[model samples]
Target: MDIQPTSGSAGQTGGFAAGGAPSSGGGLINSDFETFLMMLTAQMKHQDPLNPVDSTQFATQLATFSSVEQQVRTNELLTALGAQMGALSVSQLSGWVGMIARAEMPVHFDGQPVTISTRAADLADRAELVVRDESGTEIQRLPIDPGRQELDWAGVSDSGAPLPAGIYELSVDSYAVDELIASDGVFVHARIVEARNENGRPILVMESGQEVAAGDIVGLRQAQ
Candidate 1:
């Protein structure tokens, strides 16, 4: 891929100036560095015969310039590395399209339901799953256990009637007491139906029609 150098960048070195069109007369070093070099060189050349320039001070200035240059080079390398890594990550995540992934999200009590594989402390009292429709409206509430439980919503409403197939969310609530906090809630294991980018960030489109960022992926598996 051809990467056109961004505008107002080439001439600006270390936040120096805004770059316009390219010029051949000017050297690589900006006016500031050039002026510093000229002043230092002139001072050394015009030093008095008796009180000459200090060799140690000159060495220190040279060392400072060298260090600054190295730092600039290091920063450029890091920026390049970051851009390359971002591209690679986006490309690799695209392979997850059409696959099922377990992503961690705040989609609590959405339409999706939760499933527990094993029993845990206070499974009966704590197990609760809530489902929601696309508009974030609560649909139904169901009780669950810490053990293997599938809180599947059969695309039905609270009146036990079939609803249109669309995106939904699930949230898990495993509270101990009436006024207590809990963590065991239903999670989503949605199939990634599509892969796309949102605001330059990679995202996965779940079969439930929910879009999730690639960074939100907690687990991944092949489509089955």
Candidate 2:
């Protein structure tokens, strides 16, 4: 359950350097703030009574320092909040493993049937399922009932033989007589094998090695 660094990340207070971020950084305003106070105290002590420091300018400088300090603290808070939310999201996604995730994307086939879900287009009288390989070459086309929303791709080619194990793209073409009307990618179902957080977003890794965003899931269901 450890989200040990999957990849490298810049330090937490990297961007806040120009603004004097106080968290995990050095030589910033917080450090400068102390140094500035000491300098100011010395200046006041050594100032000639005939030409004392101006009250108005001194107040303005203090106010500017106060504003910069507040800004740095705000950045620190935002970093903390982002971390908490990312952790919470990944923890929630842990339950998704062993469940089915339905999404619209290229599918990997390994000599097994892949379930494809489609949204039936009402305008077309005829529908055809088109399968393309990873190279974008059309490999198979089959007539399908226009009203059918789900089908299991048998991973077979036109030669009545099994297709090799690889990634394939699937889409449905809707035709109105001689005119092609709508073409939409179909949803391919895969099981979630692992879930991890990447830059505050949950990434679900499928059994096929495909990665899907947690928010991109079109449907979820228990595995049969």
Best by TM-score: 2
Query: For all candidates, what are the clash counts?
Result: 10, 0
Alpha-carbon TM-score of each model against the true structure: 0.63, 0.79
- Residue-wise lDDT of candidate 1 within 1-224, one digit each (tens)? 22222223222222112132112222332554565465556555555545554555555655565555556667777877877776777788778887878775434224334332323345345655666776989877766564555444455666876656565556666665653455443445777877765556777877656778888787887876
Q: Root-mean-square deviation of each candidate, in angstroms?
A: 10.7, 11.6
* Pairs of residues at least 3 apart in sequence or in different chains that clash in candidate 2: none
Best by lDDT: 2
Cα lDDT tens digits, model 2, 116-214, are: 887547888988999999999999899888775888899998888999999999998988875788898899889999999898898999988999999
Instruction: State the TM-score for model 1.
Output: 0.63
Per-residue error at 203 for model 2, in Å? Answer: 0.8
